[model samples]
Target: MVHETAAPASELVLEPFELSDDFYQRPHDAYDLLRARGAAHFVRFPDGGTGWLVTDYEAAKAVFLDPAVSKALKSPGAQAALGGDAGGAAMFGDMMLFYDPPEHTRLRALVNRAFSGRAVRELAPRITELADGLLAGLAEDAATEQDLLDRYAFPLPMLVICELLGVPNEDRDSFRAWSTTLVSNDETPEARGAAVSQFLGYIDGLIRAKQEAPADDLLSELISASEDGDRLSHRELISMVFLLLIAGFETTVNLISNAVAILLTDNGVRAALAADPGRMADFVEEALRFESPAGEGTFRYTTAPVTVGGIEIPAGQRVLVSMAAADRDPSRFDDPHRVDLDRADKNHLAFGYGVHRCVGAPLARMEGGVALTRLLAAYPDLVLATDTELSWRKSLIVRGLTALPVRLRP
Candidate 1:
């Protein structure tokens, strides 16, 4: 194993183990040093597993598009390598994101119809209604600052997904709690296992209900499709529901929250956007590029030897493509650090590239666009709440603010 001495004061111990702290808390100075060293480097997992961290834009894209490098699930001993616990098993087995082609293609194709632009467009009216309702709740407390996340950002996406999936409105709280536990970084092995089991139980119940009496919801469609042998297996169906519940809500939640946070912090951008509602699309793209929710792409394992950024990755090794770093690559983007709403080359890897691109991109874009436009229009004087550090989520795979406190304009 290659052992480079840990950079001065680096949180990563330069051993074959996981980094000490979550990537979000790591000092910017450390990131700068690593960036300067190269876009990709070897990092040790806490379990003594070695993995590659790809930070450069070209290298990240290459790793993402290259079929030679398999997603972590495809790797032998992948379960043990990725914590070998119930959570790991659940992630690899049920999520299409972890699977490679053929299976990935089939699963993604089955769900793609439901998330198509036409289908998502049909929900725009409802999405707007939901956004307005959430905003209405915030309006009552306009005099005092509110946590945008709790008041608006979080619920909007969750509600939309639940409604789409035909999850009963009364069961929303239970769904939220179960989802929170499954995704929470604070949960222990036993706790996570229990949460996973409970979540699966909930999905099983929901699926059985859908099977008995179909509805016009997405889950109903998935159930029908699977039953007709046009889609997934029993296990796959449960996994897809779980995946949709998590992905359907989580990514959009961060996107909307992050966009508002950026706009509130930057007066010029906010004023510019507020002046023209038509610029909402471009502004959303900039937000995705500047502060992507998924900091890194899904993990992949080398099915065969592959060279990335001039470094040779041996077979059976894990690799991570840093979406955050790629979106900021100066080579592809001029003045990479600045948020340019008008930047013509916004072809960022934020949604990823190649076959595994995010299936919910259109819906995410619509939700974010509508949320920001309505937000800026309604609260022309929205400003950040004072004395809040804007705690970020701890997951290295997903990047987002935990809470965004803001004073809605009267």
Candidate 2:
């Protein structure tokens, strides 16, 4: 449904979009309106910069895979929107996220081994064991209410990521605070900047320790990669770790939380999976499509004028691929809002679309499958503590609940 034919960027008077209170409360409704209007909406982002928000699935997929769209977020407005950086590129360094082509290709290759299929396959037993341990503690309170995000969802992935990166368990508390603030859309730039500084500083010290005494861990491997024939600069090394730690667990945290919420709320989806444990993988995939954890993909800047879904967006403007909207676009899926675990199409853009698609998705799927299996096995009657509407966290990109209150037994 192209609302209008494409034209030059300067000749367009696009309808403005904003992140209103209604959007925060019922994002799907807002997305429905946007999709009905056109593929992309021209608007100012919360950070006070103008850009295009692509909610249509076809347009978003095209945007993600389009070479014309660069990963660089160099615009000063984008910087302010992403939470003003204290040291800019030098501080954040050459993050793989911001790189394109040869640079992105090279950096991703370096850390790819750490998350290889073989590596993750070997971690299966450990992951199961970790899930078992968490469930044991979670079961201690037989009938008491608990926030699944705090008790199960957050820790499971956080622990796995920390273990993979060789981060000390004692420092996880700090990571939780920093990560929450970092992903939050409500935090002030000053606060976000402080968190970034402290986070990188901690990583710096940890790297120093790993260098003095290398260990059998991903961080050690990354450090070695940096020192070896294919060298990684100090900034790149720190940024890689930062990217891994944040991307490694945060998305998974929301995935697990969102899935449980669905299982507790939707009887049909729950019953189908409960009847057949073999359907766990299918359930996880459907959950990703049904309730994408990462609301919007990482911001992108256009290098050249581009036309998407009947609208022309000029070069140098920011582009946001709204997975939250795209995943639910009615044109792409039949009854897009329903949780149809049996649906034939599982090709959702929840993780993302192209080279920049979340590299941790494999690990996330494996962990999510394990966590959901163990959770249901432990508490077959898991249900929300109250029948109230769950409060979603207000974040620029993070899609999760402020708290997922549930009881071990219904």
Candidate 3:
């Protein structure tokens, strides 16, 4: 769903404007400007699609509640509405992120078992062990200064997901490379395509192997996962694996990296968390709000004219709910910019809300908590590396540092 605009409709109170690429690099100021103008602002993507960008917390929560405000790219109109956005719904294959109700509902049901509270709780010891190994590696590296994202943040979740999904240790590097390429805006279209091709091809081969020799892993379980006698098809299995494989770790790596960056820079937060390691849950949640890893929620399309934040968007228009903006809305969060571990409101849209809320959230939170606890306990003097400028990943939907250079010792 998309509506092209050269000029604003009189009713469109917040004027439509094109967003700059730099917004990703420095977004809080832009978010403050938009949120002040109104709850919903009509914005145009650089790629030529026009739609509403929801900055108000209430408006964003409303959008999540409305099932008619769609997520599927199955329609040509929907695809056109998100024109030229490289990592559009297609990159995700036919996973839950791109689907609404029935399909999403079915997929969520079939996959929920893998990320249930009990399942994640069961994964805690292994997660702790993974974090310890990575931290030990970081400590032993030649340089005292290291890119935490490379040394620990990326590896913790990547290793956990790979192990859970049954990816062989030898092939984990290939998956990491392919994943990095697919989510990267710097990668050329051909490169991204090939990465997607290679990722799916590998998954295809793995699925066959799992079929012949099913193991005690999520992939094997997904192959047999069924909802009301509806089992996963070969394609669905691949998409589900792709979703789990990438989303399972990519978002988390960002969360870990972002959280660590916060812990290093925000002394009050770091001290509180360090004093009482149990406060890490609060630390992680606040970090998600202050700097959402998934800066923007997945692109949503309007199936019918829908009113959000007092703006009525016509049918067949794409809508982007900025979880990054919504999380920091002053109305919902007092002193939103501050990194307070004891904010009265514990709710945040970091994992999103409603039906499509990330099914893997419990697991991500556990991983984030474990990673931070392990690192801080090991390196109480960790600080951002001298002369380092944190580089945010260029992807529009992803909001995390490409590298988090830090000194393990003061």
Candidate scoring better on lDDT of 1 and 3: 3
Assess every candidate by TM-score: 0.90, 0.92, 0.92
Question: In lDDT terms, how accurate is model 1?
Answer: 0.75
How many clashes does the backbone of model 3 have?
5
TM-score of 2: 0.92
lDDT, candidate 3, at 22: 71
Worst 10 residues of 2 by lDDT: 78-87
- What is the C-alpha local distance difference test score of each model? 0.75, 0.82, 0.81
Q: RMSD of candidate 2 to the true fold?
A: 3.8
For residue 138, give model 1's deviation from the true position in Å: 1.5
Off by over 4 Å in 2: 1-15, 46-49, 75-88, 117-119, 226-228
**What are the per-model C-alpha RMSD values against the true structure?**
3.7, 3.8, 3.3
Candidate 1 positional error at 200, Å: 1.1
Candidate 1 structure quality by residue, lDDT tens digits, 1-410:
22355455454424332355444654233344456667677776323446887777888888888988776464563543354432375444767877888878888878876555343558889998998888877787887878888878888888899888888877767767776666655656687677788888889899999889988888887766641367677788888888888888888888999898888778878878868878899999999998887777457777677887766776666787878877887777898778888899978888888888888888889888888777776788788877656778766567778788888973
lDDT of 2 by residue, 38-132 (tens): 89888655555557889999999999988878775554544544455413556554799887777888887877755553435577688889998
The candidate with the higher TM-score, 1 or 3, is 3
